[model samples]
Target: MYEIIFNLHSFLAYIVLAILGIALINAILGLTGKKDFTLEKDFRISLFALILSHLQLLVGLVLYFVSARGFSAIQEFGMGGLTSAARLLAVEHPFINILALVFITIGWSKHKNLMEASRKFKTIAIFYGIGLLLILSRLPWSQWF
Candidate 1:
């Protein structure tokens, strides 16, 4: 069960990151060009990115609870006792990812409330770009790739 969830989470991370990147790029282009926020493409891309990210967050939360390198590591080694690698997995990754999701969610909500196309694009670009950076920063690169 743990392995399945772990693999799923890993696989989904790639998809989520790709979609998020596309969405961010699209948003930036729309903002810079002052393009109309079309429902067909613009809305769909942002919505897809938002949904995928939320799903990834859910799977990650489950993995955190079940994986030995996650909460178990923190339990086994007290906060201060954990090595840098251990701390990254047991603390930094999960916490920062959660915060990243919050930013994405906020961006989605804020974009919806606004009537201006430029503002909507700007909000998504800024928020999702930050979230993407946060996720990239805390990824366990040694273990993952």
Candidate 2:
């Protein structure tokens, strides 16, 4: 169970990263080019990125609960006793990812309510950019490589 979930979470991370990156780049282009926010391209990519990110978060939550490298390590060793690597997996990664998701969600919501294309592009650029940075900052880069 743990292995299946762990693998799923890892696989999902790659997809999430790629889509989110593309979304961010799309947003940046829309803003710079002063392009109208099209449902076909701009909106679809952002929504896809948002949905995929939510899925990744759900899978990660399950992995966190079940994996020894996640919450179990915290429970077994306590917070202070965990090595930096253990703390990175058990604490930092989950917390940062959740916060990133919140930013992404806010971006999605705000984009929907905005009347102007510029505002929509700007909203996604700022919020999704922040979310992407946050996720990148705490990822277990060593493990991924």
Candidate 3:
């Protein structure tokens, strides 16, 4: 069960990052080009990225509770007893990822209430971009390799 959930979480992360990158790049391009936000493409892309990212978060949440390197690690080590790698896996990654999701959600909400194309693009660019950066910052790069 742990292996299945862990693999799902890891696999979904790649998809999430790809969609988020596409959405972020699209927003940046739209903002710079002063392009109109179209429902067919821009809206769908952002929505897809948001949904997929949330799904990844959910999977990660489950994995965190079940994996030995996650919540159980903290319980075993009592925080101060943890090494840097263990702390990253057990705490920092999950916490930062949740915060990133909040920023992404905020960006989605703010974009919906906007009337101007530029403002919408700008809102997503700044907020989702930050979210992306946060996710990247906390990723277990060494573990992946």
In model 2, the number of clashes is 0
For model 2, residues 29-64, the per-residue Cα lDDT tens digits are 999999999999999999999999999999999999
Candidate 3 has a TM-score of 0.98
Poorly placed runs, candidate 1 (over 4 Å): none
Better of 1 and 3 by TM-score: 3
Please, what are the lDDT tens digits per residue for candidate 3 over residues 43-103? 9999999999899999999999988999899898799999999999999999999999999
TM-score of predicted structure 1: 0.97
TM-score of each: 0.97, 0.98, 0.98
Global lDDT of each candidate: 0.95, 0.96, 0.95
The C-alpha RMSD in Å for every predicted model, in order, reads 0.8, 0.6, 0.6
Backbone clash numbers for all candidates listed: 0, 0, 0
Give candidate 2 misplaced runs (Cα > 4 Å): none
Query: Candidate 2 at 47: error in angstroms?
Result: 0.4
